[model samples]
Target chain A: MRRIVVKVWEFPVRLVHWTNFLAILVLCATGAYIHWPFLSTPTTAFPYVMGWMRLAHFVAGWALLAGLLVRLYWGLVGNRYARIGTFFPYLTRQGRKSFLGVLRYYALLSPRLPPHLGHNALALTVYSGIFAVMAFQVVSGFALLGQADPSGTTYLLTGWIFSFVSNGWVRFAHYAATFVMGAFLIAHVYAMWVSDLAERDGTSGSLFSGYKYGELEEFEDFGPRPR
Target chain B: MAHDPHNPRETALEQYLESRGVDRRSFLKFCTAVTATLALPASFARKVAAAVAADDRPSVIWLHLQECTGDTESFLRASRPTAAEVILDYLSVDYHETIMAAAGHQVEEVRRHTMEQYKGKYIAVVEGGIPTKDGGVYGCIGGHSMVDVVTEVCGNAAATICVGTCSAYGGIQAAAPNPTGAVGVGELLPSIPLVNLPGCPLNAPNLTATIVHFLTFGTLPRTDSLKRPLFAYGKRIHDNCERRAHFDAGQFVERWGDPGHRQGWCLYKMGCKGPATSHNCPQVRWNDGLGWPVGQGHGCVGCSEPGFWDTMGPLYERLPNVPGFGVETTATKVGLGIMAATAAGVAVHGVAKSIQLRAVEKKEGN
Candidate 1:
């Protein structure tokens, strides 16, 4: 058969995705070190290992926040596939039907893979949940970081968090979120690889090249008849 | 017992302090210390002095219920210009259940008389949690339930002060499987203007300074959402810790009796709750600036925080278990366990999928 190359992921979305991925990687490392500093420097004087770790964590956190904000903004103005509405797979009847179909495919009850331009319904739901977790981390991260300098503007903004729960519980939530994101990362990558191998539709390369190979009929969802 | 408000010379505090040989200069110095302790500037010392020397000293009624008397003991042990002497000389402590000379019917009579005499003018200092289960039968004083007594006493009180962790946030008595259903004073009397000076054994200076703040300004000191004075509970213990430099340097004492512990390194890894706990144990230093829990090489138990016994426990562990699991499990353990299980499940699923794929390919070949 014939295959149609379609633009799925926009440049901005891909850029934010890559940047967020890097930020989360650094954040996990630095956050763990700060919580439990496994490494001990011979001299307590010169390097300030924990200080650098915390600084890196905070900088990466802010960077992630900036990328998230930009991506959310782009979700408003980008192509149909990049729209925020696509993330909520249960919002439409077609999307819901596709979700069930994808679920059956994962359960090994169905051998056929559903055709789609961007993310499948199941992937959309999972990514949406991951975004929610990321948002929680950003909020709680700032709350924990602001505590270091209580007199600063950040503290003023987030200090009320303590009134609701103690700092210990807040730190616990942040740590728990890391593990959640970690688990998501593992499952997400594995699923992506499996999908790329099984479908052979340039799924993995689409993230880098911003295009996916699909059946001609699938292109009809983009609106208007293709010449 | 009403005294002239116009004449400072007629005040009982001046006469009492003067009789104890506490000079005017020494009294002023005490006021200055109190002012500083309250996080007030140097100029507020004069206002404090004048307030203390005023003709009307506020009467105080101290109630002890369901407690170990540790708060009273700590109050007596307060040094650094000696809070016991200053507090005794300053306030008209008419009804203290522990220290009062009068006892039995006479003491009860005096308590009644004093409560009536100084109604809406005295400070009610509650020192322990009040049991509410079974009509508060778990705790009582002089044939009155703790709940009834607190409600009655605090009803007419100008303000109420919860002087220890028990009275502040139910402390250990309200820990898991709280059979007695003990609760903090705030929970009992939510409408009362209450101040919590929470600690395992209440910090004496906080009580003294709070009283002085009232004596000076005729109002309670500014408090946090927990009803704790901001000057004492304004910052986390970790922020002002002596070994904070070691914390920032990524140096930690991994275990007790380790080289790091010997060298006085950070105790964060040893489950020091200092980072989460807010108190002035580092700056105020228990026993007249001599030492504190961290200074003496032990982690802070976070006794001042609400539900600490229930929430901040496994004392030496980094994190407490998530509640309502019917089993004790730390957040890290649960989180990492789930992640491991997911990874294992993913691998199993992947293997199964590859087997199914090979079977499909074989079927196609046939």
Candidate 2:
């Protein structure tokens, strides 16, 4: 066996990855403030703290949505490892078995684990769920934003959401999605750290550098990935 | 019921008001206010005055179904100033079930006569929800279900006006797990043109202005998707809220009777749905220009929105009760719990991974 580096995440994927990370961070901070403002001033005074917090939240929300759109586009036309198919690991019987193996390993039932050059079966599946939630957040966020000005173009596009779900629940769900994402992020980072430590591989560093190190064959191969 | 459009004997509203005691000046002032509320230009006040004083007024048939008659009580029992008097007189309400001197079957007969006489001409003002479940068995009058009654009444009318939240969007009766399956007039009469004035009991002036707009424009005012007139429901209460300065400053009344409450801080923390609700309550108050709920230091209950009773609940709290978490748990509590659990899971996973790493490294060394 020999060690060689394989480019896994493309440049656009990495760009969107960090962009969404920063966007989500800013969004959570500013969203929490807008949800329940922590800052205080005299009632007689108009410091516009809530106003600024709302502006920041809307800006960050837009950034996250933009990053998501870019990622979705890349998923359609990116590498084999970066394709949208990678996000659905349980669609096939082989994929389901691979998913079970990853799930069992994470449960600590077995010391052995399945390894992939890109995302493993479970990681991609979880990423898909998070992406769905993120999409819902964008829709619900825009729906609420459109409410501030009912006659505006934004309302023309998003006001139909109120016809399905009640207006208040949309707001509650958007706030809850942040925490759901937060919990997923905690597990995601921890899982990556453990995998990097256990495999002695560049799983954690793969996000930033778009490359992963592994030993594949008698000949050193740096191609797409090992099937 | 001797109403004729071009009757030479018909008393014009202006002549009638002048014959009683109301002067021209007070009546025009009322017109100005109505036009302003309708978001019309200052010049349109004259048009409103002309419409109000023009020959015979539109006959209104006020129907009462599953309601408390709070709307009628509020509208009739108020201060009855000259402005309100002009509105009351201009309405020409033909058959109000609660206030009409004629008894039950006689009024029903009168209603039948009016419907026949002014078929596709009279304005039907429905005041409450109509029960539709179990063949609309919950509420009935003269052995007829309210659904059928409203269908028959509003069916032949030119246009219908839903006067309260009950009639607009199935108010308190349509709250969660609705027993009777009560629904609004809009839902009952889909084909009929409607203007919804939804408040707990809607501001009488809003209903008055809606009538004035109909009389003036010869068409219903432009409405939002919910059928509420845009002039009233177009802007959110938050944008026009007097407490907006406090909201911008982040000074919320954290709890009831707190220092913030005493000092008249923003009621957002008290679950004021004003931010989400659309109404001119802060401008056109309840009970004849007296203090409104917020003016009296109570948070808005969002009475105007469709199905507000269900959508804007845990009414005393800042959020709608999160679904599936029971009634007590809020998103903040649930979110904090999820975060704490995630933190704990991460810590345990970290410890487990370190132990596994040590075991593997020791085995490799051997």
Clashes, model 2: 0
**Candidate 2 DockQ score?**
0.59
lDDT of the candidates, in the order given: 0.83, 0.84
- For candidate 2, what is the lDDT? 0.84
lDDT of 2 by residue, B57-109 (tens): 66888899988998887677676556655566456557887767788787788
Q: What is the interface RMSD of each candidate, in Å?
A: 1.9, 1.8
Strongest candidate by lDDT: 2
Q: On residues B1-366, what C-alpha lDDT tens digit does candidate 1 reach at each position? A: 233457556556665665666656677777888788899999988898887677677788888988998988885664443534565535645888777878888887887887899899988998888899999999878899999999999888998989889999887889978889989999988989889999988777788888888887778899877888988988889889999988888888988999999999999989999988889888877676688899999999898989998777768878766777645677767878888988998898788777776677688884
Two-chain complex of model 1, DockQ on C-alpha atoms against the true structure: 0.60
TM-score each candidate.
Answer: 0.92, 0.92
Which stretches of model 1 miss by more than 4 angstroms?
A44-47, A148-166, A221-227, B1-12, B79-84, B322-329, B351-366
TM-score, chain B, each candidate:
0.89, 0.92
